[model samples]
Target: MSYHNPVLLQESVDALAIKKDGVYVDVTFGGGGHSKEILKRLGGNGKLFGFDQDPDAQGNVIDDERFVLIPENFRYISRFLRFYDVRKIDGVLADLGVSSHQFDEADRGFSTRFDGDLDMRMNQKSKTSAKEIINDYSEEKLAEILFLYGELRNSRNIAKTIVGKREEEKIETSLQLRKVLQRHLPKAKEHKIIAQIFQAIRIEVNEELDVLKEFLEQIPNLLNEEGRLSVISYHSLEDRLVKRFIRTGLFSGEPVKDIFGNSNVPLQKVGKLIVPTPQEIKINNRARSAKLRIATIKH
Candidate 1:
């Protein structure tokens, strides 16, 4: 299967406003789809750096001398870039959330269609996995993640159900966990509820929200003057952070204003929120929930 079909390919890259010889970064270089597009827009002197913590993505690394793939999480983007003496970058593109490749691989435990071990770590090297979260997390902790990340209203009850079931046998696989929560799944909303449960565990196991926040905090310092940031977030939690940061340069609370009421924000939104066209969604169902937000460093 194809590693991943790039979503909003032209739109996201165009938002970067690529400079021929400018430096760029694709932070979520899952299948190198967006990275390849960025390379096409670059001249001989142009350089591109890609970051992916997943060992699976290493095989897809571009062979071009001008391209470099850093096998590390983008939360450490600044620190890693500094190692290459890259002090400032012209643009950065991020396609956040799990990749299609990850979802299609049943053993990786990302999709509801398949029965596999409960492992959803973006970087397989990570210590925590969905199996651990399902089998070991406190009911309260599980409920909190379900409520916050998955936005499930009956999170406490669902978490309670899992806890009750696991006491008899450890929930080691996706199917096992799904069966345990069968009560919560009416035929009408079974898939949706299970997906939400999986998403909650996946987020906790990978610390996705925290990692995203860390990565966003580094962008203002990493970009050159007028440097562009194009991020495609797959869900509301991720999109909200990107949107608020671009508007106020902070995740929460209003930006501080001067006596005259002028606020000093680091990044400004480039345009209105962008989403996949119906045609694009038809081609790639995963693109249905994708939201692309563009921003540039404030002058």
Candidate 2:
């Protein structure tokens, strides 16, 4: 089976607006689909760097002089690039969220379709895992994760049930936790509700929001004038942050305005939001939720 299929392949690459000898970064190099395409477009002098916390992706590492694989998280994109003497890049692309391989592997516990341990850390080296969050977090904290991250309407009941159940026995596996949440699961939307719960835990385990924020903050400094950022987010929360940052240079509110009343914006939105076509979504169901946003630093 394919390790992973790239989403919005052509559209995303086009968004990069690659120059023949320009430097680029593939911040979420899952199966290297986007990176491979970038390599194809690059001239002999061009270079590409990839980041993936999962060791499983190491096998997909290409052995090209211009291609370098960093088995670290993208949150450290700037630090690692500096280590490699790469101060600026012409473009960066990130396809965020759980990779297809992670969802397919039952042992990784990133999906509701399988029975496995509740460990959802993208980086195995990371200390916090879904298992810890489920088994050790306080009731209030659990409620917050469900409500804020999962966006579950029944978050209070789910949290109450989890706290009440865990006292009798530990919840270590996905199935065990699923059973606890099953009561609150909407019968009409079982698949979606469960997926949301899994997503919340996965995000928490990987510190995805924090990582994305750090990664975004570094983009302006890392990009050359007119450097582009092409990001494909799999959910509304991620998409909203990307959209806001690209438009106003901040996540929560508008960028500060000068006394002259002109709002400060670091990156200009390159194009309207892009989504996979019906044909692409038919071939890859995962593309259904994907949203592509592009922006370029003003010269």
Candidate 3:
């Protein structure tokens, strides 16, 4: 159950500004790293709830009276918390995207470094897998995911190639998909290109962006007054959504201002973007691209 190193371990949790007896939620409770840390800082009567859709995470759940592991997705944070007779929360933490263990486990198909099946479902029970996307999706849909999620410049050509190859033989595995686009992978940038392709498919399979939006939309209403939100995002896509949401409370367009010229937003940014230091990145390569953003409910 060695899930992940939990990037920004102290920084992200500290950003929560934990009150000894405050109730908190860890939306991505992979490995229970952050949750465990929160427990150490909680006093008597403090409660901590965690949510993780991945079955593997359940194995790493901490055995403590103060902690409750909700074996569900964070997108339904509010609903599940209500079932426990919990309404207001003092803080929430979300470590967005796939966990390190998911990528390292070849069978999961999250990493381009591994040669495994094309199964990139965050929740093992998910219906739409990376294999389905590559084998059944239309050329247009494939290209859209590649461009939007992977940010690949030649997404159209890549999608056309995948469609053309799948017509001859099913693209059932990660290596097969890579071999299909071999010509596109220049020797120098092969790994980078392939990683992008894998990322695009994984995102689509998990409906990651949609889930993130839904989870974030519920944060404001769930948090109590002066509640804090700490999020660590690995890529620009997730970071952008979080950054924009905290600043304007809207995914797009500016927040409307009153006659006094004050815009009404749900949360206010706590401080500047926090990134891993050189020491952290050296120890955990995954922390290199990580960005931590903290915000509090607007009064």
What is the C-alpha local distance difference test score of each model?
Answer: 0.94, 0.91, 0.93
Off by over 4 Å in 3: none
Task: Write one digit per residue (lDDT tens) for candidate 1, span 1-299.
Answer: 29999999999999999999999999999999999999999999999999999999999989999999999999999999999999899999999999999999999999999999999999888899998888888999999999999999999999899899889989898888888888899999998888888888889989999999999999999999979999999988999999999999999999999999999999989989999999999999999999999999887
Report the candidate with higher lDDT, 2 versus 3.
3
For candidate 3, the C-alpha RMSD (Å) to the true structure equals 1.0
- Clash statistics: count for each candidate: 0, 0, 0
**Number of the top lDDT candidate:** 1
Q: Model 1: what TM-score? A: 0.99
Q: Residue-wise lDDT of candidate 3 within 135-163, one digit each (tens)? A: 99999999999999999999999999999
Give lDDT tens digits, candidate 2, residues 45-103: 99999999899999899989999999999999999999999999999999999889999
Poorest 10 consecutive residues by lDDT, candidate 1? 173-182
Least lDDT summed over 10 consecutive residues: which range in candidate 3?
1-10
